[model samples]
Target: MPLLDVKNLSVNFNTLEGTVRAVQGVSFSLKKREIIGIVGESGCGKSVTVRSILRLIPMPPGEISEGRIMFNGENLLALDQKRLRGIRGSNISMIFQEPMTSLNPVFTIGNQISETFKVHQKMNKQRARKATINILEKVSIPSPEKRFEEYPHQLSGGMRQRVMIAIALACQPKLLIADEPTTALDMTVQAQILDLMLQLSDQFDTSILLITHDLGIVAQTASKVIVMYAGKIIETGSVSSIFKHPFHPYTIGLIKSLPRMGLRSQYGKKPLHEIPGIVPSMNENISGCWFAPRCDQSMDICRKVAPLQKYIDSDHSVSCWLFN
Candidate 1:
C-alpha cells in the first residue's frame, strides 16, 4: 500500500462573504520513500490540503467537507484527537512555510525541539535535550549548544528554518510534509537546505509531500508531480512526463511561464510568458471546469461540463475536455 492516500478530499472555509470551497476532489498517493511535489499558484489549496492531512484546520472557520486521508492503512479523518495526536509527530510531521510564525517566540529552540521528543518518544527532560542537540547538529546548525538557548527571533531566516527542520525530524517520522520549506532563503541557502532534506530523507526512508509554487524546485526534488489550479488537481504524472509533455492547458501554461536558460537570449528582451488571468476566488461559484475561463484551448464543453481525469498512459493523467 502507498504510504499516504488522499481520496476525494474537499476543504471549505466559512467566512462572512460566503463558504469558500478551497479544495475540490483532490486525490493522490505517495509511495514508500518517494517524494511527491504539489505545485500551483498561491490560492490553489496546496497548503490547505497538507494541513488537512494533519487535522490542523480550525473547525469554526475551516472544515474537511468531504473525503478520506489514509496514512499507513489508517484513516486520519476518522481518528479522534488523542489518536491523531499520537500519529502527528511520531508518524507524520510537517514543516510549515514560515518559521517565525510557526515557532513559539517565548520558547527556546531546545525547549521546542525537545518537546517533540518528550511528547512522542517519552524521553526525560535531559534525554530530550540531548536528542534535540543531536538533531540540531544533524541539520548542520553550527554551535548547537549555543543555539539551544536561543529564541526564534534571535536566529537568521536560514537558521530559523534549520531549527524548524530539526524539530520536524526529531522523531524520524515516516512521512514529512514540507510546505515551501525554502521560501525567503537566498539561492545558496535554499540549495543547501534542499540537499540537507534529501540527505535526511535517504537516511530515514521518509516519504515527503513537498508543496511549493516553484516548478524548478519540483524538477530538482520530486519523482512525481501534481499540478493544482483553483483548488483542484488538473494534472498528475511522473516528473519527467509532466515537465516534457504537459497535456493540460493549465499545466502547459505553468511550464511555459518558467524562464528557460536559453530562451532568454532567443527572445531578445521579450517578456517572459505568463498565464493570463487570475485564479478564480473560491467563493465564486465556478460552473464546469474551474480553469475553463483561462484556458486557451477551452471549448463549449469545457464551459458547460467539468471533465474527469483521463489517463493518457500508465503514469500520466489530465483533467480537460481536450483529453476527453
Candidate 2:
C-alpha cells in the first residue's frame, strides 16, 4: 500500500462575496522514500491541498468540504484536533515556505525545537536539549550546541531555514511536506538544501510531498510531477513523461516558460518566453476547463464543456480536450 494517499480533496473558503473553491477534487498517492512534486503557478491550490492533509486551514472562513487523507492506513481528516496534533509532527511533518516568519521570535531556537520533544516524548529538559542540538547538527547548522541558544533573528536566512528543517525532523516523521522549502535562497544554497532533503529522506526512509512553483526545481528533484491549475489538477505523470510528452496546454506553457540559460540575448539576459493572459478570476462559475481562457489551442468544446481526466498511459493522465 502507498505510504500516504490523498483522494478527492476539496477545500472552500467562505467569503462575504461567495464561496471560493481553493481546491477541487485533487487526488494522488505517495510512496515511502519517494519524492512527488506538485508544480503550478501561484494560487493554484498546491499549498491549500497539503494544508488540508494536516487540517491546518481554519474553519468559519475555510472548510474542508470533502476529502480523504489516508496516511499509514488511517484517515487523517476524520481525526479530531487532539488526535491530529499527535500525528502532525510525529507521523507527518511540515516545513513551511517562510522560515523567518515561521519561527517564533519570542522564543530561542532551542526552546522552539525542544517544545516538540517535551510535548510528544515527555523528555526532560536535558534530553530535549540534547535532541534539539542533535537535530540542528543533522541539518548542518554550525556549532549546534551554541546556536541552540540563539534567537531566530540572529541567524541568516539560509541558517533560519535549516532551523525550520531541524524542527520538522524533531520526531523523525515518516512523511515530510516541504512547501516551497527553498524559496528566496541563492541558487547554490537552493541546490544544497534540495540535495540535503533527498539525502535525509533516504537516510531516514521517509516520503516527501514537495510543493514548488519553480519547474526547474521540479525537473531536478521530482520522480513524479503533478501539474495543477486554478484549483484543479490538470496533468500528472512521471517526470520524464511530463517533460517529454506534456499533453495539456497549461503544462506545455509552463515548460516553455522556463528560461534557457544557453540561449541569451545580445544584452546577456536569457530570453524568457511568457504565456499571455493572466489566470482567469474565480468570480464566475468555473465551467468547462478553467484553463480554456488562457490556452492557445482552446476549442469550442474546451470553452463550453469540462474535460474529465483521461488516461494516456498506465502512469500518465491529463485533463484537456486535446488529449481526448
Best by lDDT: 1
Error of 1 at 226 (Å): 0.3
Query: Tens digit of lDDT per residue, candidate 2, span 1-324?
Result: 999999999999999888889898999999888899999888889999998999888887999999898999999988988999999888899998888899999899999999999988899999999999988889999899899889999998889888888878778889999999999788898888888888888888888999999888888988999999988999999999999999998898888888766656545875467788997665558679999888888899987889999999999999998889
lDDT scores in order: 0.92, 0.89
Q: Please, what are the lDDT tens digits per residue for candidate 1 over residues 1-324?
A: 999999999999999999999999999999999999999999999999999999898997999989998899999999999999999888999988787899999999999999999999999999998999999999999999999999999999889889988988889999999999998788999999999999998899899999999999999999999999989999999999999999999899888887788776776767767777899999999789999998888899988888999999999999999988
Find the 10 residues in a row with the least total lDDT in model 1: 263-272
Model 2 root-mean-square deviation: 1.9
Candidate 1 has an lDDT of 0.92
Local error of candidate 2 at 104, Å? 0.4
What are the clash counts of all predictions, listed in order?
Answer: 0, 0
After best superposition, candidate 2 residue 273: deviation in angstroms?
A: 3.6
